[model samples]
Target chain A: MRRYYVDYFLIFLGSFLIVYIVLPIAVILVLQIFDFSMLLKALQDERVLKALKNTLITSTATMLISLIFGVPLGYVLARKDFRGKSIIQGIVDVPIVIPHSVVGIMLLITFSSAIVDNYIGIIMAMLFVSASFTINSARDGFLAIDENLEHVARTLGASKLRTFFTISLPLALPSILSGAIMTFARAMSEVGSILIVAYYPKTAQILVMEYFENYGLRASRPIAVLLILISLTIFITMRWIVGRRRYA
Target chain B: MLKLKNVSKDWKEFKIENIELEVKKNEYFVILGPSGAGKTLLLETIAGIHIPDSGRIYMDGIDVTELPPERREIAYIPQNYALFPHMSVYDNIAYGLKIRKAGNIDETVRRLAEVLGIVHLLNRKPKTLSGGEQQRVAIARALAVQPKILLLDEPFSNLDVQIRSKLMEEIKRWRREFEFTAVHVTHNFEEAFCLADRIGIMLNGRIVQVGKPDNVFLKPKNEDIARFLGYENIFEGHADGSRVRIGGITLSSNVTTFGRIKVAIRPEDVIISKSDGEFEAKVESIESFGFASKVTLSINGLKLKALTTTSKIIEEKIREGDRVYVSLRGFNLL
Candidate 1:
């Protein structure tokens, strides 16, 4: 008797979910393609191309930096017990919950002092907010690995670092890759923080907002539409590469 | 040669207290006990993974207590084998030598893998291999290092019966062929019997007895040791200066105990016959093993275990309701 109610409830919830999440995206997608000239103007702009390049380079750099630092951090969190471990983990996840504007303000306070306003400031802001994704994912990946793998390597005469690089890293690759992708995506969409810390060299998200504010809806719509298309394209390509690796 | 002198380690809930052991060069030393005896802790201590709070670890007379694993030069294969899943079988075997910057590393790895019958599995990763194959690769990887001593903790417990027996035989053969010294720890007496040149019986983190497997089984140091060794014939009896008072009967024995004492006897020592003896017992039931049949008997409601040949059981025609005269030819008093 209860099973029937459960089935009906599940169907209701699933349909509601489909309508809730997919409806707005469907509307925007249809408007961007069907309304024609908006897509044309977005594609032709040199400023849009520059923003695209900036976003791609900064996000990619953010992801690379995250992987290099995050894998070890994840492994330590997953495998070891040390003082302040839980506190350190909580610290790693702090940026994700904070407001984007707040993150931007915090970066400005720290980086506006002349040492970090260059590439360092941009990269650090992106990493601060996005690296948590990689760290958390890598932690899960490392946790899934059987500890016996590292133990065996140690017994076989491989040093701790060698065992980590040769065994732990490969087995945890899927998770690390997922984390990197998440960080990349998060960094690419960053606008509020980049605006405060490094606004002169505009990212695509900032460009879209700038066009919308300066020149009314007509001039701004094309850039907004362009930003969305380019972001989606890069996101889809990353997913495809990771998906292939999974099968392999 | 491996030696652990006054070794003590505490692993949260379990503590191995003052464990002292020595495995001679080329000796197959097996540590046997029930659960929570800290057998695995002893193995790990020798492996240098767990440092003892108070002990001196010596390999071939050199003190290596404070040495890191690489400097200690001990190879340890845990129960799970800990195979590196990312590396191919060939790379896994080659890892140690590659790091140590040794010449002819390929030759060494290839030779060990071939000996372990894992040469054909060289290119495959550990996850692609079966349990038995992975176990062999783990062993091969350890053997490739050619450490002074090898520690194996429950290496056979993971395999199925069919594979376990075959692997046991292969492991024995490999040990003899390579002349490698090993310290194996397990709860199974059969593993201790078949593989060990010498056995150490551990109880509550202490090495209670260390000797040939037969000697330890035949002569347990105490009643608890006897029971731990699967000798389930322990009874509290009184030695009243003349003879000991057991279940409803007093046996004539020269062995003397001061007051209330525990009498331990191996089931194999008790003999059941239809002749006049000092005592009498009724046959409860008989269960058959491959070579031996265990006859359960009742002496004034006190249960006793006796092992006899299957032919003796048949010739005596022992049944649940049958009456038989029981006698003790001899016993090992602990």
Candidate 2:
């Protein structure tokens, strides 16, 4: 019976990590409620609106481009085996391992002067740092599906491409959607890459950084709190949708 | 007709070598082998799931060796049924039709679903259905396409014995109605006996023998096959014209041969007696097997087994360490 208390104490100690993160976000949210006018003013600011719009547009573009390229790569990684497959898989994970600032520098070197000041540059930088989530998640989703399902479709007079679209794609859609959401979130939160590549089409993260640098914590706190609030809301909603249909 | 000439494939641990097989139109061919005998690999190769390293596959006199699965018009029901978990039974059955944009999709799916007795399960996903229900759905999905050949990879293996036999009967009925050729693979001899027009026994990675069910079961072509088919006593012996000699015992054979050869006798064919027989042996062990008891007998440095009824065992007062007379009812020389 005394051992039970020890076990409970251990659990309580482990739960402090959750509290550590929740306490700061909770403090920020509660403080912003008292200074609600600052949040309203941040929302009304044309520069803030433009920055948020840019973030949304670029993240969505990154997600669509990730889907176009990542899904096929995911399927290949999941289904096929050839020489150097391990090397290919390792390369897919390189973005997650490397620093985001390095990714921005690498993209700049590869794309040269054309990529340094364009909206495409922002998307490319964000995609370089974030697309790993989509690719790995989609690969896992494809791996979860049985190879027999695809074979059965093939034996039933459906071509390979047809089987992929009709069976594998639909079955793995939930995981892919969840991955896209994460990729979008990661792209939205990206700051280092965007800061170097394209400063004109500033994302919300960069905007928050600019405000903090120009006018201390008071000016920047409202935008930071609003960004956190919106990100949390969208993240929770997407997760709920994923949980409801999590076949993959 | 479907034919495979020298079909071969090599995986890391399993390989099929020089496989030659033929199935006539509307024939039910069963490939019988023990576990790890490359049975599933051969089935997959026929289904085009695995491209053969070297072979030619023919269907209706057309060379389909280079054709992909879709172009070959074959339907494969894998061991686990492999029903799409995300799709409802209706959609699963309709998937092939939808892909091809075939005519009368709903009517065809409805008719096949009704035939397979899964009409009630059309709205349910595969995970929601019972094993038998899922099996029925898989069969419906495969049959909906009306392919040239249907490949069944141990379709009844995951079911209880009762369900297995029931599905076996259902498969026959469906085949008769649909008139489709099939290549069914299983390790169970009972399955081969129940559903096969012709059976092939596979060992290691080769089809050691192919014949009618009774022929293959009763007379395996070689010592390896005989051993695989549960022939208890197999001995290398000398065949001299009409008689074969094993150790000190000489037995008459209908096969006229000369020189060294292998002889096989099934356990059930060894007749055991208490009083009068040519050979005398001591009882080694007796094991009770429900309706029958398996008796092991040692004679002249040879071990042989016999299956006798439980009543006969009690009547004869047979037990371990008892002396018993034994005689060979028949034996095959290979």
Candidate 3:
């Protein structure tokens, strides 16, 4: 009887947070269902389409850049132990903890105006705030693999590079893919950093804010609903892909 | 042939120190040690996985201490087999050949798989295979490369008793067919006895004794080796000629030693009889082990263990707290 009470209490406490999270998204989607024609109109608007395109392109570029650099860093952090390794790991996690606006300001100061206020600057901002996800997930992925497999491959006449390509990299792909998806999602939702770095090539998130402030909630609701739908669709699809590949 | 002049490695908790060893061509050398004795470390050091701190390794009389494992042409199969989980059994067996870009890759893989009895498992992933099947795949994968020396670290330790014995017998046949030198490590006495051409008894990260199986089993080098070899009756005794005196009792031994020394008597050599024997002893305990029972006898403050068949115990009606006659057939001076 005591155990039953404890379980009920714990579940009640958890359900409050779950409702708190699901309520806002549920209300927005339900409200948009009544305004479905407005959503169709926003999807056809050139300005809205351009902002969505910019968001997709820049976020994708960010994801690719992060994959190119972050995966190797993750593998190194996972496999090697050297001086200042903890410091390196700490550095990888710094971007995640830093405020997104601070990330934009840091990127603005690091590069010249020629680089900022452009597509590159927007990508730089997104990558700064989101690369940590890829790095950490890839690190965890590599750590989950057995080192004995690499050792056996070496003894089987495979060079270290060959072993990495054939054994370690393939096994860690699912984790890496999930990390990339997280990076894409994080980049897409980024508005604070882009507002500071490059407001000209407006992302869908920045446009939502602009619409809300300039034209009130009625003008912004459709784009907000559209952004949520697209992000959820991509997120769920990517997760499904990763889940399928994981078991395969 | 592989040789280590003085290999050593130091880790935080364990160390393999100044290991001097050699394996002749096609010699099946087994390193027998208890867990944490650094058997795996020694094997890895020979495979060039971990470079020794301050010693040289020679392969066929050529210094290869600084060489990596890939260049050393050594194959290692760890206790878990370490089969590539992402690949099919066929691809695993063919991995080395593909790396070398050798000709007749399919033929080599098929031949090895056939010999190891894993031909039917060619298309299956390693995760789907049984332990025995996985072991066979690991063996086939390692053997496909035709390495100069095969280093197996407790290969059959994961299998059940029936499969373990079967694999042990098949491994002997595989070694003959493959004609490869091997350095196998295990803590099982039966494995060491059945498979080793020469046995090296490892204790505390050192090769304490190395000899033929019978000699090493019958004659251990020191007190520690004797204790590890299951000599339960060990005592410091004064020896004169072939007789040793231990605590108010003198026992006859085969080895001749002088003055103060340590002697070890295997429990199997301690004979217990009801009618006639050298000394009378009180049966302290009788523990049954299904087919055999270990009988502990106490005579004049000294304890000795004797192993006898369960049928004999039943026939003679030996039980705890009974008076029995005990005699030592032989003893080893340590």
Q: lDDT tens string, model 1, B73-189?
A: 778888888777657889888887887888999899888988899999999978789889988998888888887788898988888889988888998899887888988999988
For candidate 3, what is the DockQ-based docking class? high
Question: What does candidate 3 score on TM?
Answer: 0.98
Clashing residue pairs in candidate 2 are: none
Among all candidates shown, the one with the greatest TM-score = 3
TM-score of the second chain, each candidate in turn, equals 0.89, 0.95, 0.98
Task: Grade the docking of candidate 1.
Answer: medium
DockQ of each: 0.60, 0.79, 0.91
Give the lDDT of residue B230 in candidate 2. 82
Across B1-334, the per-residue lDDT of candidate 3 in tens digits comes to 7888878898657789888888999999999999999999898888888889888999999999999999999999999999999999999999999999999999999899899998999999999999999999999999999999999999888899999999999999998899999999999999999999999999998988999999999999999999999999898899999888998898777778789998799999999999889999999999999999999999987988998889999999988999999888888887
True-structure RMSD for candidate 2? 2.1
Error of 1 at B334 (Å): 1.4
2 or 3: which has the higher lDDT? 3
Query: Whose DockQ is greatest here?
Result: 3
Each prediction's fraction of true contacts recovered: 0.62, 0.91, 0.89
Rank by DockQ (best first): 3, 2, 1
Q: Higher lDDT: candidate 1 or 2?
A: 2
The clash numbers for all candidates, in the given order, read 0, 0, 0
TM-score of the second chain, cand. 1: 0.89
lDDT for each residue of candidate 3 in A122-220, tens digit (9 for 90 to 100): 998899999999999999999999999999999998999999999999999999999999999999999888999899888899999999999899789
Overall lDDT per candidate, in order of appearance: 0.83, 0.89, 0.92
Scored against the true structure, residue A243 in model 1 reaches a CA lDDT of 73
